[model samples]
Target: MSVYNQPRRRVIQMIMIGMILLIVARLFVLQVVEKKYAKLADANAVSRKVVYPSRGIIFDRKGKSILGNDAMYDLVVIPANAKNIDTAYLCQILNIDKEEYKKRMLTAILKNGRVRQSVFAPLLPPEVFGRLQESMYLFQPGFELVQRQIRSYPYAAAASILGYIGEISPQLLDNEAYKAYQMGDYLGLTGLEKTYENVLMGQRGIQYLVKDNLNRPQGPYENGEFDSAAVAGKNLRLSLDIELQVLGENLMKNKIGSIVAIDPTTGGILAMVSSPTFDPNLLTGSYRSANFSRLYQDTTKPLFNRALQARYPPGSTFKPMIALVALDEGVITPSYGYPCGGAYYGCSRPIRCTHSGGGHAANLRLALANSCNSYFSHVYRLSVDAQKFGGIKIGGMQKWADYMHAFGFGHRIGVDVPGENGGLIPDSAFYNRRYKGSWNSCTSVFLGIGQGEVLLTPLQMANAMCIVANKGYYYIPHFVRSIDNDDTDLLAKYKEKHVVAHISDSAYQTVINGMTDVIERGTGRKAAIEGVRVGGKTGTAENKAIINGVLTAQKDHSMFVAFAPADNPKIAIAVVVENAGFGATYAAPIASLMMEKYLKDSIPAKRNPVVKFLLEANTIPPAMQQKSKLDSLNRKAAATLKNGAGGRTFR
Candidate 1:
């Protein structure tokens, strides 16, 4: 019985030892090595909550808070844990009907599943939050309140520039760029907010809580070791001057236009006012959707950003640029003369001059000051027909287009904002495409006077003024001066200087002198300010719009461009008042007042009447106002916003 029995005993012993080891290993894995099973078992009782970090604070140049945060609460729910809660009572606290409650619940479930937390009701007002806070315990683990920050404007201004934040859309959620963002996250929709979203949206944090059988939160899961802390976004310091912006907006009231003022030294935008603008607060808080729809549908298009996007003929305000180009091209010298006895008879179709006298067209300086339509028309014809570049085909039109591009025309200026429209500057190819090279400089002679196919945004016009002020170069215009704690290469582009034109300083001086005379002795005389030698040009851009399938002549758009202290220019501004009769009537005075307000900080006592007139002037034609509901809607919204903010009455 000996050997066989011993082997069998040994086999049995080894098998028993292996079984014992397996049992010990399994127990160790369940208790320590593999935590997955334990976590799964604890899944029903655990809630992972998102802690949204406060968005970055936006401050004006003077450190005044333009956009700030107000504390709010978002009622989030983990549907899996929402069992015994009183649905009726929860809806009452949330101020929603039963059907709405069901809709939100269904949305939450479909969004991230029943176990994950989803926003039930977001951005509760302080009063609503207070009411809900008192009865929060009744909602238990299924519904918990998470702190959030909604935007608030101290000065309800610059709605277009500041932009607004909104909940992430489904398309954005699926976008690769927004992969890091969750569905309930808020992102900037437009303006500077949209441009600097990455810098403004801080890192989100997460916290885990444990719930009991009744879905009531017991305490923190894993004693809060796994929780992450939220980091507040970086603060942005803008280049905007609060007072200047407010004043510009005020002056633009009851008008349809834009005011773009830039600091020529740095290309920083001091104030950009798109008339018919609404309160920025309208796009914040709970009323954002309704108000946004109203704004989008309004006939006047207050939501449209005119300064950066609206393209219009530069009118006589473009004469200086043409003069500069002509002087630089040697097509016309500073002393070149063109005889114009009220009308330029050189062209087949004689062009009429606004100035009746022929003496003013004797030289470029006098011609520019007078804005002699005949002189500029002659200059344009000569430049395009010059012997060097073959007439309007071989290289003439192309060269002219090149000059325009050098002045920051016909392309994006790379502004640090979203939705910048590059105004059109046509080349020979464009004309050839349309006319098969049949077009001569005479056919497109309107280019000389800033009419025809020429178009420019108020931003481009303002930048052109900056270029003229800076002599030959400019910084790419930007809203934010700098970003706090920024190490990334975000603002590198704005810091670089761009040399658009290389004309000599003397040529610029001659142009400047002409512009100065314009303010002192010519049409822009209304723009002259005492003690400050301002150089400006007044423009009455002809307005023609197609109505009922017929081209109708409308009121001319009033425009003016100016730079102060002529020698060491500080601010360069462009103002456009649509449907106004003449440039001097509305645009020039507004520009003058703005310059005075910025440089002198107050309008002189003598000019108080002018201020009163401008403030009270209703440039918007009554017929247009009657046809379009935009002005009324804007007024009502402004009144509501002013009253709500506890500010002074709508300016």
Candidate 2:
């Protein structure tokens, strides 16, 4: 009995000792091991401030700074620290009423819970900042002026391409993609700024400052032991030539359309212009919000990126690709001829040809040079109904569509730019759904001449020209040439070569020769430059839109696609001019001017008249302007149109 009692006593003693050790461990964790509550307790006396690093600079291929940082200030506030401050004087300095001051204070409190700091007024002008800085000490620790950097554009061009930055939205704050960002931070809203945001937005730094009872900053906390330095963002280099971009934008002034130019060798975009572009500076600094609202409400849609988003029928500009597909499929040879009297009579509704001379399409090259509608329509039918794959429904049309897909049609070409539209390229399945599988090649004959079901973006058309210029291979079109200090494989795809149609080089040579003839002696003669050999195609795309609740035919959209220095092509370009009749009249000259500028660095003095005329032409329909509800919209447009040229013959 004595031994059992001894063992029980030892066990009870051990249990008591274990309880004491647990209590000591808990105390150690609370007072020493964990620092969170300690930090919270010291929060009243210590202020942890965030330092935002300057964003990366953007340079053109020639190393000129297109986007750079401008010095600015942000007014920050801590609600709990606000005490004995001169609200009235502060309001006067900020140029805000008392009510607005209270509202802003309440907003800052709501954003940061009265303890942490939040933006009271962001992107303040230098004059306003100077005034605020003079009386800052009167406000104690409640309000502080923090240095900031805002985007500045010296050229004030490429508004759509450069995009803008704005305050982060609550919705974005909740997204995992923006988990690192706070409410007051600014983020890219569109264009290249949005695409390279992660690389451009550098890491934030933290610094701790000791505070007094009155919330005034005393000195660095613990000699800045917990401070962290910010890392600067990596710079970026773009393939865009700002001068070329300015030239394209100037040429597109008072017009409604887009121009996309690419380096055929590297697939780097040389110049991209969406007409009606606003100055990029309008979307920067303190006036961004108001100017943005004005630009957004403008009926001309100055914010719309037509080069990447607008879809149009390829028109006769698509003839070379059709010729490639036919040549690849053995449905037509380079010497294939058609004598349909300048019109395709195979279809129930005859498709007219720009070449009206009898027996004009004596060969495939001759047909392409003359843009004979009858020749292409016959070739399209032959490819879709060839015996190689059963018939249109069984395999022929699908095979044809396969060729289209290989050529980067019916899918986005994956340009580095955002908001690209994969233009439509119809297949057998599409026809099966639209026509209940009752359609034949002749049923969709308009597609043969690029007028029906087949639509393409200006980027896609330019890429197609690259494929032709390179004799079947193309690189993905991209804007940035390289990113400074970046080692990631994010841009690997752009360097890859895509072989489309798998057509022989000889077949491409035939098509290219015909295009050269178009600029030399055919409809696209206006596109020919002085010393440069240019291969080009002119397209007069039929435009139809509903006006006054009735579908009516409007003026044709002028279009042209070209490659220059025909022997060793460098630049491939596509231009579209809305509501402008005849591709040869407007689009061809625009392309020619751009080529001349790119190749020769400036338009020849002899072609100065052509440049002046193009620089001053307005083709927007009068009905469209009258339909705009914007007050004085038509009047403003008319005032600008006064500096432009009048129309000549449609063709």
Best by TM-score: 1
Residue 161 displacement (Å), model 1: 0.4
Whole-model alpha-carbon lDDT for candidate 1: 0.86
Candidate 1 wrong stretches, greater than 4 Å: 1-44, 78-84, 107-117, 210-223, 627-651
What lDDT does the true structure give each of the candidates?
Answer: 0.86, 0.84
Per-residue alpha-carbon lDDT of candidate 2 for residues 546-621, written as tens digits (9 for 90 to 100):
9799989888999999999898998999999999999998999999988888888887788889888898787876
lDDT of 1 at 446: 89
The lDDT of model 2 is: 0.84
Candidate 2 lDDT score at position 495? 92
For candidate 1, the C-alpha RMSD (Å) to the true structure equals 5.8
Give the true-structure RMSD of model 2.
6.0
Q: lDDT, candidate 2, residue 528?
A: 87
